[model samples]
Target chain A: MTHATLALLTLAACAPAERGRTLVIAAYTTPREVLSEQLLPAFREDWRRRHGEEVRFETSYQGSGSQSRAVAAGLEADVVWLSLEPDVERLVGAGLVTGDWRGTPTGGLASSSVAVIGVREGNPLQLHSWADLEREGVEVLTPNVRTSGGAMWGVMAIAGAADRRGADPLRALGATLARVRVMDKGARESMLSFEKGVGDAIITYENEVVVARRAGVPLDYAVPAQTIRIENPAAVVDAYADRHGTRDLAEALVAFLGEAPQQEVMGRYGLRPVREGVDCPDLPALSEVFTVRDLGGWEAVQGRIFADGALYDQALSLSRGQR
Target chain B: MSVRWGLAGWAITAGVALWVGALVALPLAAVGAEALHRGPGPALAAVLHPDALRALALSASLATWVAAVNTVGGLAVAWALVRWDFPGRRLLAAAVDLPFAVPTLVVGVLFVALLGPNTTLGRALEAAGLRVVYAWPGMAVALCFVTLPFVVRAVEPVLAELDPAEQEAARTLGATRWQVWSRVVIPPLIPPLVAGGGQSLARALGEFGAMAVVSGNVPRETLVASVYVLGEVEAGQVGDAAAVSLVLLALAAAAQLAGRRAGRWLGAA
Candidate 1:
């Protein structure tokens, strides 16, 4: 090793005049196009105009379950954007995110998409509602709820519709899973399976169907009468942002997602806007919709439906018994 | 010996011990400790849960099928390369080791593309009512593909060492081809075949990447133990994942030890 000279020591060139910062984002698999193309770039431009310094971004995308677990297990992401509220709740429980994220930064919600069903072209089977999926000989594709937070939204939609009709939600869930011939770990994988001609119908997001259709895959989607609103949350991880000193940049990107310009990009890319006035005329309105808060909060619903020995386990056993 | 040489040997031995202790033994010990962190009772109960039991049974059956298929397939491949001077013999020999080099996840995706519902063969198979992908057949095939190299590599050395002179003498002694082959050729190959099958069984038990893609992951029906551990982890039940993993690790470890013992019994090692 060469010894440093006195001139170099006197220079003390640690901080450059145009210092750069990195904002790391760990997000769910969906919304990859919008975030990479419009939201992130727009935020970078906005930050450069204000601060006159360059800001770089690093992003990783995975299924909500794995992505949330990665943040909790020390991925050091400045921002954690995920599919559902429970995933953000996991980080809060891990003490990686602030407890009151929902009160600020746009109620901790970045974008929205309602659960919908995708079927073959022309709707030969006419699978309109969740009840249509329970028909005999109709093969349904869904992800395992145990491994996917997005999958939980699909289950809740069906169960909520079943409850609305005075039918037993548990039995309805059992019947739906019985016809589930293809179940993958993530909703995206389930969609791929559907694209590969593996299933008669796929229970997924409206945005997924819209995105796939825009990509020229010949498919049609049915927005069920009674559906669940999918609210995707984005927040700055507290400990990670503090450690990286990128909290302001991280917070700005998330807040930008809920603003008019980026929210319009989110709508164009198929994800619904979190704000009410953002115009996405092509996206259909849900006939009847419910939020997670309408049923209960994330903690209550998680325990009641998905906990061990809970309703999902009962549904599995019931479905097996039916088989 | 001089003091330098003596010191070097002692240091080398200690270094090896430390390396193995840290790299191999410590992680396994941590798994065991985590499994029993809530005590052995909960760990036992975790494995004995209904879903866990079903997953364990599925995993064991997959291992058994992989072992049987690999043993037969591996012997045929090994026999062909050793006994025949056919066209493209060297290419065939090189191809036998390809499975070991390929990542098993890619192997799973390859199987999916070749035999999934969209393909012509896959469609014909479905029309014939033989569901392959997302079913038992696909899981078995995926496991067998990943483990085939173990048995083939194991049997090749033993098969190549057999002497032509001994078989010729036996044939000259009024022994028919079948009798000569059965009596002389078969007995010596048994130990290596068993050893190879054992290795295949151990490997199949712990396989995750391929099985994850091929199996539909339905609980109590198609879900295997390793995938079940993944589900538990994704569900935020790390304790349950550790317990089930401990059980799988024990079974795989037992299979490996059995294979080593069989190899040593015939000095095949």
Candidate 2:
């Protein structure tokens, strides 16, 4: 090896062991990271003062479903702050949580909206609502709903669109789904992919669009006539936390997220408050805009849209036969 | 035997075996254990998911084509590097390794810059009524870029070790150039080619970065098995994701076995 390489290797050998009291956390994507880094440290300090316990977060960021699966598969999470409600329901089903979570925890944290169509700067399609996505040359892009929390919301929004249209909406959706040039696996991946010119428009969360726009991505979010409100649910993994005797602290942290201090952090990340009147300049206030709700729970949604993966099969068959 | 040395050797061997057992065997065991869950129903269902199955089929075909292309192209490039005295020969050698040095994500981004709708080449292609960015062709291009090094690195050293006297002797016997290559030169290169092809297949199958940046991750058309497994995991279906991964592992193992059998058959011929 070269001298520089040898020296570098020698320096690496002197690295210190990890320190601090680690709190294992499972969260979904960008919002979780911002919450942990910017918000949680302050909360941790507060907990130390009140309870005389020191804890630092060691977190993993993944898709909502994936995080839920990890918990199901015994990933040993102290707390799970997820992107949607259905994921939390899985934990309850697994018996990791006790009773209804909304009654047990610090109220509930649920105030985000599902993805909307984010168009190019010029608005070339003259597009509005889910129907506009069905137009030819539209080239829609959305994170795969099967994997992303935002995608769950997006699926609800699509289903809501079908409901508004009445009679038949899948036919309209299928055509729009066909025009989608890319389906990113996650929200951030979708953002980056969209910025790289993969498609004419993207369907992602309003907050993601705000973040992207702040980063100077040439995109604009157009809220359709009806869109789903993203109901993000956070809860202390009761059995795990109670076993560790961190229950009081865990309750406090979850409660803290419900109040104004946590709202400030969510606001910075483009997450609208779950309740009304905690206004931020850039984001749409929760009360003003019309956000749609999914008619079914996670299971039903998965069963209809993503369970069989038929859509993917059709898309592949179409592309393969072409080239 | 020296007592001190013997004890040290036994301890060292035990330590190494234990480390390997923990690192590799445990994960493999977990996969096997999980595979046995639901009596193979979940495993079969996971692999049979339309999106995953499509990705599996697409990834396999793409890997095969990419490996074949690399085999021929790599051999030609190795031959030129060894047999010719072109200007900037050293520079050419460095350039051949360029794909390895650059990150795969950057390679995908580079293609986007060159062929995206924003670029002149993109406009030209657009005018020709052709699309390259979000198509199967783009995926092939990305896979080719990442796997380019394997075949070249495998063959180059082997080709260098080959003596020139064998080629000269064949020519002296009035054998044609093609005859010399087919009968004398191609035989020993089989092992390295198989090795390179296997490595390339593994790399191409696991590839996510390039496809993520360039091919658009469109369902079925561009969603590779790795990305699809990730999608399942993200959907809060660990059992399904693990099942998909188990299926991918099985497919990879089968491909390797087929490659070995083909190598043996070619060697016998």
Model 1 regions more than 4 Å off: A1-19, B2-13, B176-178, B262-269
RMSD, each candidate, Å? 3.5, 6.2
Overall lDDT per candidate, in order of appearance: 0.86, 0.73
Q: How much DockQ does model 2 earn?
A: 0.45
- TM-score of chain A, all candidates: 0.91, 0.80
Worst 10 residues of 2 chain A by lDDT: A285-294
Best by DockQ: 1
Best by lDDT: 1
Tell me the TM-score of model 2.
Answer: 0.79
* TM-scores, one per candidate: 0.92, 0.79
Candidate 1 CA-lDDT value: 0.86
